[model samples]
Target: MKPLVILLAAAAAFGADPPAREKLPTSRADLENGEKLYQANCGLCHGTKGDGGRGAVLAGRKLSRAADDAALVKVIEEGVRGTEMPGAWQLSARESRQVAAFVRSLSRVSSKPVPGDPSRGAELYARNHCSACHTIRGLGGSAGPDLSDTGLRRNPAFLRTSLTDPEAELPRSYQLVSIRSNSGSTITGARLSEDSFSIQVGDSSGKVHSFWKHEISELKKERGKSAMPSYKQLSSADLDDLVAYLSSLKEAS
Candidate 1:
């Protein structure tokens, strides 16, 4: 009886099942580290934070909720080929986890509305030259896709990556074309309209070209690639603000 009493006392002192083993952070620390890593490695083009610069802004957009941590890890490891997002095999498993955390944080923060600044976003959109390529509500150029109802088609996470790495996940239709002419000039554009005889392409300058497909000596098409620039130079906060603005561009009411 004395021994039994001592055993129970010792168990109680150990503090009830050892405090549940301190549940591991769902990559929270990794997320913080990822933010730092992004600044160091991906900031130049993707922006310091995640705002558009030479690249796309990636804070508020939702890409694919179906992609879990493992899927994201694979992408980080393998990298998206045929795009500016070079393979990041340099990162270890832990480091990749950290980046995923940072990416997830973008949406959580940008989910709220910007107080007293509904119009600020519209102004920013124009000032940033987003309209130069992307079309919104029948405005802007035809060089990029129409973002008239982007809020409905894309999620915040997806939008963030799209900004940070435009070529990362490209739409099926917007394939990249690299045409080498007889004069040794190379023309790269997004395939706007194509056929066996003639093809229409939209270049980065917002100019469209109609070329005879048969006349093209060497024509290469990189599927699942985009001609859009990467916005890896903006700050994380700016990226968040930009994403917030874009996400709010929903159809009227």
Candidate 2:
């Protein structure tokens, strides 16, 4: 049978929703074929190992898009709207499934359920001013990552560690920066973008500041650091509640 026919047949089998279990290519030849397809199609953005560069990291991490085999297949076939991700309609449905399985084989996040009351954690999240930096469902500041999908993107253990020691796996993108203008004014904020000539920053107050390098007397890039403070000072129960709350935030499908 032709590849396009195979693709259409598979799509018809699943209909609107994905099947319960994703059928991955099992044989060595099949796996190799998937890898070749992945390299040709996905490697430019997702990286060969899916460690991420221009795209979100996929290696050893949980994916925000449907993580299951079937869901992954659907996401690959249909794509997410209003995002850089695009549907791979050029590929056959069987190829889409194959690539999804290969992507799944790259990483797996912990399935451990978060502990504590999510409602109580919600209170704690607000009390601790988590929204001062992070955004949830577009209701908070943008200094930190949007918590709308942290649960799907990060595992429980990673969330706990983030609160306890923020520097552990801080991405370079989130590094803090301080720039002193020639007029004795200082702007401390998270770097939004930077180039040799100019830099953009989002301050704690959710204000953006853009400055040319020549206008600034001093510019400091604080590496291996985050504007977010560690939560080790919080009481044990409060800490757990915060982690529980953060870990419970999964983007609605």
lDDT of each: 0.67, 0.77
Best by TM-score: 2
Q: Per-prediction RMSD in angstroms? A: 12.9, 8.7
Encode model 1's per-residue lDDT on 34-120: one tens digit a residue.
888777766665556554343444466553521455665566667656545665778876776677667656645554343323356
Q: Give the TM-score comparing model 1 with the true structure, all chains together.
A: 0.51
- Badly placed stretches (over 4 Å) of model 2 are 1-23, 27-110
lDDT of residue 40 for candidate 2:
92
Candidate 1: list runs displaced more than 4 Å: 1-118, 182-184
Candidate 1 lDDT at 88 equals 70
